[model samples]
Target: MRKLIIGITGASGACYGIRALQMLREIEDVQTHLVISPSGMRTALEEGTGLSGEDIRALADVCHHHKDIGASIASGSFRADGMLVAPCSIKTLSGIAHCYADDLMTRAADVCLKERRRVVLMVRETPLHAGHITLMDQATRSGAIIMPPVPGFYTQPKTIEDLVTQTVGRALDLFDIDHPSVRRWKKECATEA
Candidate 1:
């Protein structure tokens, strides 16, 4: 079974994280370990997911508190395949970039990096300054894939949910997990005229 650590930060796009969880639940082989920052919870409420903290937690196989620094996932020995910080806040990115490991989310990311495991950060901010770029560079240098949740228009999404599914599906693809919602690109071929 592949174990995946999912982190939901306080960034604006909480839907990415939520959709990731919902989609992962469909795959029988993947076990999801979820950790949502306090600000993450607040943002989910502010963004009107219409689901309480309990409702969100119910989506995961296991849920860890953000303050639990000593959780199983915080250690490098834990055999998690990788981690995805959907809608990663700049603060979380800085922590991961600097190896601060102050909380479970960043600490787990640090552990994954130290173990040379795949780490993807979906940074959500826009109009970024040099500092954000620097942080992204540092995280990338440390073996984390910085993936911002930019929608692909080729899918011709008709709803906000469709866009969210496509972005989340791409993130899962990095982990080698195939999500049925992902609309893969297929080139059109023309016959000889």
Candidate 2:
């Protein structure tokens, strides 16, 4: 079984993380360990997902509290395949970039980076200033993939859910987890006029 750790932060797009869990559930071989920052839960509520913290926790195979620094996922020896921080807030990104590991979410990401595992951070901030760019650069230098939730127009997305699914699907692609929902780019064949 492939074990993946997932973190949800207080960023605006809570749906990305929730959709990730929902999609991962369809893949039987993938076991998910979820950690939600306190702000993440509040944001989820505010974003109107209608899912309480318990409801969200129920989606994961294992749920770790953000404050639980002792969680299995916080250790490099735990052997998780990798981690994904969907809707990764700037605060969380800063923590991961600096190796601050103050909470389980950042700690697990730190462990993943130290272990040379794939750590995809779906940073959700727009109108980013230079400092945010610098933090992203720092995190990349430390071996984290900074993937902003930018939707692909080529997919011809018609709904917000479509855009979210595409982004989440691409993020999962980094872990080599295939989901039927992701639409791949194809070269168009030119016909003779």
Candidate 3:
């Protein structure tokens, strides 16, 4: 089984994380372990996922408390394929870059880095400053992929859902997890019959 660790932080784009979990649940062989920060839960409510944090937790195969630094995922021996922090907050990004494992999400990411496993952070910040740039640089040096969810309009998305799913799909692609929602760029658009 492929083990995937998903972290959700307090960011505006909670929908990305929610949609990712919904897609992951459809795959039979993937075992998803989830950890959500308290602020993340609040953002889910504020952003109106229409699903409570508990409801979201139900989507995962296993859910860990944000404060549980002793969780299995915090250790390098947990044997996960990779970690993804979708809609990652800048605060969480800074913490992960600095190896500040004050919470399970950061701790798990740190472990992934130490284990040489892929750690993709879908950072959800805009109008970034020099400090954010430095943190991203530091994180990249530490083996983290900083993926901001920038939309590709070339996909000809007609709805906001299209954009969100496309971003989430691309994030899953980083881990090589196949999602049906992605609309890959083609050399030419298919013509009507």
Candidate 4:
């Protein structure tokens, strides 16, 4: 069974995390472990996700509290294939970059880096300044992938849902998890040619 640790920070794009969780549920033999920051829950509700915080938690096979620093995922010994910080807030990125285990989300991310596991951060910020760029550099040097969920216009998405699905699918691709909904550019180009 492939074990994946998912962290949802207090960023604006809660949909990325929620969509990832929803898609992962359909994949057999893949177990999803989730952790949501306090602000993340608030954002989910405030953004009108149509699901209560508890309902969102139910999508995962296991859920860890953001305050639970002693959770299994916080330890390096707990083996996981990878970790994804979807909608990674700049605050969380700073914490992970500095190796500060102040919260469970950062702690688990730290553990993943130390364990030589893949860590993908779907950072949700724009108009980047020097500080954000520096932290991203630091995180990348520590073996984390800074993946901002930018939409692909070539897919010619007609709805917001299509863009969200494509972004989430690409994030999952980093873990080599195949999401059927992803519209591959190569395939589309090939068909066009």
Of 1 and 3, the candidate ahead on lDDT is 1
Q: Total clashing residue pairs per candidate?
A: 0, 0, 0, 0
lDDT for 86 in candidate 2 is 96
For candidate 3, lDDT tens digit of each residue in 80-173? 9999998899999999999999999999999999999999999888899999999999999999999999999989999888999999999999
Global Cα lDDT for candidate 1: 0.96
Which regions of candidate 4 are displaced past 4 Å?
A: 187-193
Candidate 2 ranges beyond 4 A from true positions: 191-193
Candidate 1: residue pairs that collide: none
* Model 1 backbone overlap count: 0
Tell me the tens digit of each residue's lDDT in model 2 across 1-193. Answer: 9999989999999899999999999999999999998899999999999899899999999999889998899887899999999999999999999999988999999999999999999999889999999999999999999999988999999999999999999999999999999999999998999
- Which 10 residues in a row give candidate 1 its minimum summed lDDT? 184-193
TM-scores for candidates 1 onward, in order: 0.98, 0.97, 0.95, 0.95
**Tens digits of lDDT, candidate 1, 1-193:** 9999999999999899999999999999999999999999999989999989999999999999999998999998999999999989999999999999999999999999999999999999999999999999999999999999999999999999999999999999999999988999999997989
Q: Candidate 2 deviates by what RMSD?
A: 1.1
Candidate 1 has a TM-score of: 0.98
TM-score for predicted model 2 compared with the true structure: 0.97
Query: What digit string (tens of lDDT, one per residue) describes model 4 on residues 1-193?
Result: 9999989988999999999999999999789999999999999999999999889999999999899998999888898999999889999999999999898999999999999999999999998999999999999999999999999998999999999999999999999999889998764234544
Highest lDDT, which number? 1
Cα shift from native, residue 65, model 3 (Å): 0.4
The residue ranges of model 3 lying beyond 4 angstroms of the native Cα positions read 189-193
Clashing residue pairs for model 4? none
